[model samples]
Target: MTQQDVVSTGSTTEGRAPKGKALAATERIQAPVGGPGRGPMGGGMVGQKAMTFGPSARRLVAQMRPDRGKAVAVVVLGVISVALMSVGPRILGQATDLVFSGLFSRTIPAGVTQEQAVEGLRRQGDGNLADMLASMDHVVPGQGVDFDAVRNVLLVVLAIYAGAALLGWLQGFVLNTVVQNTVYRMREEVEAKINRLPLGYFDRSPRGELLSRVTNDIDNVSQTLQQTMSQLMTSLMTVVAVLAMMIWISPLLALIALVSVPISLLVTRAIMKRSQGMFVAQWRRTGRLNAHIEETFSGHSLVKVFGRQHEVEETFAEENDELYRVSFGAQFVSGLIMPSMMFVGNLNYVVIAVVGGLRVASGSLSLGEVQAFIQYTRQFTQPLTTVASMMNLLQSGVASAERVFELLDAEEEPVDAPATSAPAVRRGEVAFEDVAFRYDEDQPLIDDLSLVARPGQTVAIVGPTGAGKTTLVNLVMRFYDVDAGRITLDGVDITAMPRSALRGQIGMVLQDTWLFEGTIRDNIAYGRPDATEEQVLEAARATFVDRFVHSLPDGYDTVIDEEGSNLSAGERQLVTIARAFLTDPALLILDEATSSVDTRTELLLQHAMAALRTDRTSFVIAHRLSTIRDADLILVMEHGAIVEQGTHDQLLHAEGTYARLYNAQFAQAVA
Candidate 1:
């Protein structure tokens, strides 16, 4: 199922075109279903297709097993409510017939006994009718009327309506609670699933798209449960009750009402067949438009700096126009359902009125029964109209549910097996033995790689872009396991150890620093959540973060905006370094950790790092040749293979790839 199948019902509202502010508000509201520019009913961008309804719907229902008793009670209440409500029109019709019968009957003198009147009719050879007439003694012709009987009928009808209303309210109340709790559980599960997913899964998926699933898709399911589920139950019950009442009143009129059903069905089927494709297009365009907006706005500054604002606007307009066109088509087509059904219903009404009038004249049917059947006919068609309108909501909801379930069912990171022994104490010694790996099997990235870092050794890796620098780091961190050979920590195979335990002993600081929206102290202590204020301050001082923190108005307690947007790039980098230092792991991985710092700060950070690396294994990846000049060992990599390995001075003297890179940087510095 495509998004086109999930058109919004709000678009069907008829009115003059919205202007100015109203137009903008409408666009925002409709952004998830339809928008400004769209294709014909059958046109829009195709998205991740929706799954078959059966499996997903069944799973969703099963998820509600915990609320099964409440759901059953709600359904039962709905049925009783509808049944009581359905009997109202028939009872009213009976009252109407009684009033008519008394109005036309022979005038009985005032104070005449009901038995006397019955005896007179009995003598006329209508003994059965006389007996029935005797019971309605107060309903005398001309001289008086049966006000008491009318009052009693009205009372009964009022009681049924009140009971139905009470039950209806109760059902809604219970259903609301069930739906809210069910959605809450689903959201919790999705959040947990996100934590269990592999990093590679995120690498291959767009962050915005994943966010759409978590927020938009799940919200759609919640809305459907809250709104559509109750309406669906009420509509179905109403249709059934209305039909039964119609038949009970008079089979002939019921048959006449039945004719409208097939006609209504045919009209609905034809319109739906044409509209479904357009609805799909509408939803698909909405998603695409939303994603484009999200992407563009997130990088708004970049677009402006690059002078590409016009291009972005043009792209947006194109998607927006497509959305409008498809939405218009889908809404227009679906709007046909109510009028057509009403037309069929009206025609059936005409037939029933004419036939029932002739029957009443022939004394075959009462005026009251015909009136009651007409009301039933109207009630029956109302549910059909409701169902028709609700189809879009139901389909959209299912589509959203399917997307959410797809994410929940996605492949997760492999779980570790039971460890044969407890993790060994580390001595800062790491080794990679003949490791081979590739992101894609057809293109090998690392081939027969072997390396070792002895205790307290510094291993600096220098390489050009696409030289597997990051991939190697990822392997060491076990973010991705090697396809062949083994990596060990202190001579023990790393794979045999649990990932959490292994990662706990390693610290990394990347070039792209990430900080959450919190105070500077909180960000510094992220790696060690339980760190004391003194420890946080020490780590901050070691990374030179304290220098800037003390200058801010609130010092360490200053609140940071999302992504640390409130701070400078260098400041963000320092916060991350502080986070790494607080952990004080046995092994450290620094990937251009000082790239964002100026010369003065870099010197201070380098001094701190040198002291921190004493008696600890450290791997530094950098493009700046001057940064690792004093390393104990330097590995020059080319095309995923190490071309040279030695101390910085030794590699510079040998004049291989490392020497050339160093000479070039040195030449540029002098120039």
Candidate 2:
């Protein structure tokens, strides 16, 4: 089968996408396939089991360690803000108590003088008896209320609230800046990490999955930071402050409120445990569904041509249904948290109100204290619910963070050795010495391979499908290092030079032509960004690319489609050849470079190739015998090894593999 067929059939496995539409880098880091938790569609959430808030989470936090000062400021501000807000209930309760005391003192049996009320309060050991009676001087006994005292207490409450508001806003502002900046830094790190990752990493990972890590996972982390950072601090502080105030008011009432804590904890833990798996499943299924949609849409033409639209739709429906089922389960389970907490909270409320009413009647507590304790009870339960919800949000965010960290922590391509040196100039001499290589350790591909090409030589490599023609070119270009042995340029090991320096001297044109969305000139000059217009035009003319450019309305300035869909296959190939020509490298590797063009265009390209090959080492990988008939050296490869090496005519006379291949093509042409 052709490589395209292999890719299409094997796409169910990870790392493969539809033809002509490889997933971008952002999509490759999504959840893994069939991992720990099973989504409705049987897919696994990406990074669900990779790491939690353990060491990996600590490392994620360490990313923000640089902003530790701002973080500390936010914490300090939050604590003060919550503390000030918590005092509002108590202060308001004190106002209620004052009003009640003044009204009680006024009702003093209607015949008692103000002196008797004051003396009675003093006898009862009231700490503020003098102040209370002085404030009541304008009030008639049993007829007037102390409005001045109420007003003063209310003013104090107002000041406390205003202070809390100001601090809360300041805290929010600083925390937002901290979270956004941290996310920004993480994105930059991810981008840098992508560059350092070896090509083999991409080969084994799906582009969609990686894209998820860069975009989706990172965004999740950012969102969680934005949402939970302030809430976590506030909730925790509120809970502590409310509990302390409740205890200060009356320890018996505080104990009554505390009964709900264990119940709430048990309910929250149960629900969280069940919903955690569903959450993982939901995200995994979401990734799978997205991948399916991407693949189907990208290959819509193939589906219609092969009349598989029904099958494709059925597959989509299956995945969609699974996603819906798991999503519903996740939402349903998590949804139960609020109502359950409310039930526990209400139960606590009932107990506090009943016991507090008895205490008030028995004179151990006042009405205002009971009211304040009820408010504290409500405040306490609220934080519990807020914390539960935040935990869920944090868990998902942590999962996504783990995935992003995984990508960042991936093994990078080996750096150039300290002693490595770049050559002053390239001489175009190439040699492969006793090379043994494999994509997998157990399945050897290239074995004991050796060859040499002197300066200015054209070496043709011809092989059948799956015979390692492309692999050989990849090794020469240093896309993959040899497992054993060494490739040398000018008698110096290529590995001794930096990868960029090694690849800088070589240019490659592959069978699959890629063109970005830009003007035709831009694509042609991509390999040599600094090329002059004259140089670009010269290369274009040599590759016969000018033939089509002149016909277009925009000439060389025409904007190509993202995939160069506006240009014919042969036209795109010619443009890539021109791009390679403009690079003007000492070594050129062309793999099936002319396979797309017609015979006439091939003839034109041959003229260009012949001129371009002067004083340069060229490796031409092709199946067409006619193009390479005059090559100085012809290497016949079969099953990853060079089975025959000779001139084309010499091989034809020997009647070996190359002879049979050339004869068959010749006979077919004559027919």
Candidate 3:
């Protein structure tokens, strides 16, 4: 079930956003389709099953060329060391054979040269340690372990152990760094990409879902790499080493052990084919449930006002129910992988034991050889099962990789056309010429339109609800570039100006205010990080926000909770205004600046707007038109077109659309 974490998010946090809007970095990406090795960035980002110690295990191994020349040499030496370890077991086997043959027969095998024959004889005689080991010591317990052979084997084994240890350590060190750094880089890049996306992109996407992709999905990737990589690699190596040992010991026994391998793999493949999609569905459902709860809680005031608790709870329950079904199935299927492989592993072990026992009874193999063969069989079953489980993990990584790819594959905003050179505001003039735009083509919010606001003047736009006033403001900001005609700044077409450069000169106080987790001074100084203390206080003072802020024990350093929930609505707006004031842009947009405030706060904010607009070009969207009587230009917008434009006195005399709106609004207030 999608449990509600209704932890106290009191209205004391009203002045700010909830915890964090910066997307989570360590996200758990579910696998989608077509395997996990690719992202939209390209076809091969990383391997999903990189954990398996097989050939693919090397993919997880950092191919990082070490910075130090000595480290490189050491690393290479370590690999050679692990390869040499196999010789110790072979030597022991040969010594066993030599001892047995000496006790039973005197003659050496045909393969022995004259010098080798002498070494074998010494080993049989058990003379001095050196003489006995040196003889067949090179062969079996040959001549025995004298100082020389003992030292050599010890050195060789030490080197092999060192090499394996080095490989193990370096693999861990580099992989951790790479995964962590990659996540950090991805978070930064994703943030930048999200900023460039059109506002319309946010219309359909849930805030929580996007957050989870950046946070939970990437975390899943990191965790998988950390815990699984080593086990997977070791298991794979064991499988390969044991299989080779099995063949060398007895090809027939090796052949008998391998009969179930294909069956286990086929079953794994079939289960994966079914489970991959279910895993992805489970994650998707979780995102939906999270989004629903977030929206319901974030906007709880509206929900309760409308008595939507039952409706929202019912919706959440249904989504949670679906998620439960999907999760149970996905997890149930995931749980099957290891167990199924173990079952096959057991069968392989039983067969090998039965067949090898019969072969030994026939006198085809030595006691020691049979002992080693049975040891190899145990190695086969365990590592084979390990390899099988690795296969499952690898497949999961592939699935997760696919999901990560899907997220990375999400369409980023297209590059702006090459019209921008360097956008500068000399006179700070803006013009919209026959602009048309839409989030969806079939439902254009802004139709063919034209307007202009000269430098050093206030342009107030008034309209009934759903009349596209805010859409017009969005056009001026080039949030969604015009589908037709063009917009310009100071006679230069804005299409030729970099969006960042264009936006750098504009200050805004939006209806929806959000503040990061920081002190009040930091929040006000957000738009100007390097702003001096005096400057921040000045901005606050202009908005009259400092009056109440100073009342707190910490004064300007008072910390605010997310979304400024610790403050009143008016306080949030003033802080936002203070942030905009610090920008000191040539152009200003006050969108519903006073909509959520009480009368006293509205008057205070109105004074702040006037202060901030002294010598700048400005646009204000007025809900209460009475506040705009002093506007230099009054534009009455209807369906994205300006139907009336003039001063308050001129429009009143004209008795047009502006006059009708004025009468209706004034009459409503009187009633």
The number of the candidate with the highest TM-score is: 2
Clashes of 2: 20
Q: Which candidate is the best by lDDT?
A: 2
lDDT digits (tens) for residues 113-187 of candidate 2:
777777787778773643445434343567556788789989999999999999999999999999999999999
| Predicted structure 1, TM vs. truth | 0.85
lDDT of 1 by residue, 120-174 (tens): 8789987656655654423555544466787899899999999999999999999
**Candidate 3 lDDT tens digits, 408-467:** 545544565675555453677888888877644566566778888999889998887757
Between prediction 1 and prediction 3, the one with superior lDDT is 1
Model 3's TM-score against the true structure: 0.78
User: Which residue segments of model 1 deviate by more than 4 Å?
Assistant: 1-47, 53-59, 106-144, 273-280
Ranked by TM-score, the better of candidates 1 and 2 is 2
Q: Please, what is the TM-score per model?
A: 0.85, 0.87, 0.78
lDDT per prediction?
0.74, 0.76, 0.64
Number of backbone collisions per candidate, in order?
19, 20, 47
RMSD of 3: 9.5
Ranking by TM-score: 2, 1, 3
